[model samples]
Target: MSELFPDGDEARTLARLHERLARAADRDALLDVGYRLVDSPVGPLLLAATEAGLVRVAFDGEVREDEVLQELAEQVGARVLAAPRRLDRAAAELEEYFAGRRRRFDVALDLRLARGFRRAVVEHLADIGYGRTASYSEVASLAGSPRAVRAVGTACALNPLPVVLPCHRVVRADGSLGQYAGGPERKRALLDLEQH
Candidate 1:
């Protein structure tokens, strides 16, 4: 959590950039697609939104940013842009979370990118809560298939929303951090942030 708050001019610059991006993103409301890269304690994150609500999120090192963006355009729409306005509320909420000032997120979500069992898993993920961890089998059971533990991992790996969905709370039955889309270290970091 220590990394959440950046002091001095850097923090101020980030705030200004966020504001400017949000305004710029707001410039084209008709496009229905807005996205921005946000700085965080973990690293840079790609945040994207739609008219429906917050959509996809990608970690800087986990996924190829360009491929993810292109896929977003092909999957959601073609009018996507690096617009911060669409991401303002989500970004603010995330900042607060990293600062250990927030537990649950209150942003609208666009879940069209996920479907079927994976969608169910994502929804169940939200119930895990901050500072709490659940086993893969447990979550799989909650998703209605106790035997689908492996599938739970896959869903988490492909999770369109990470921090917002709180997939980091999922763990191995042995109480170890499993494979995370953002890698195990980040998973540990998020878990540590909450646990402490």
Candidate 2:
């Protein structure tokens, strides 16, 4: 909200607390939910959320998918249920994107976990576009902190939206593929996929 860091440090802290509140809501009365498993260039992605909004997007390696869904339900106060149809649009769009048939994301996302400098960096990443890349320093400068290259890297690692937010497009200033939440290999694959 309000681009996360429209001002300074005070705004950053407030946005962070707001995000924590969003994540902490519905701790007791976990509603009905839906889920879908979609394939991506990296691996399988599990998309789940309540009728309230999209809650979880997990990649491989987390074998405890049920637990993750339960945690999401508890966080959102919604009962978990598999509903691939509810996620049809997201699945299809992702498929198209990975297949190089689509360049931009057309899915509604709940990015409340992202805020402050992270939020600003993500917003700038979204504007990076397919087949294009930026250095961490570039992103930091865009975020109004030209000297915060390391901070920009932190923001990229904290990105919740990933491909939708285009964090893969941000690379090291030396033209190296940097770290990604999904791993650097996956990041390379994403960039390679988009290149063609």
CA lDDT, every prediction? 0.89, 0.74
Q: Best candidate, lDDT-wise?
A: 1
Displacement of residue 169 (Cα, Å) in model 1 is 0.7
Q: For model 2, what is the alpha-carbon lDDT of residue 37?
A: 79
Segments in model 2 whose C-alpha atoms lie over 4 Å from true places: 1-33, 50-56, 62-67, 70-75
lDDT string, candidate 2, 49-122, tens digits: 55545545776654467776766666554556565555677778788887789999767766655678877887
lDDT of 1 by residue, 1-196 (tens): 9889767698789878866765765764655578889999999999999988999989998878899889998999887767776788999999999999999999999999989999999999988978999999999999999999999999999999999998999999899888898989999999999986
- Model 1, 14: alpha-carbon shift in Å? 20
Scored by Cα lDDT, where does model 2 land? 0.74
User: Worst 10-residue stretch by lDDT in candidate 1?
Assistant: 23-32
- TM-score list, all predictions: 0.86, 0.73
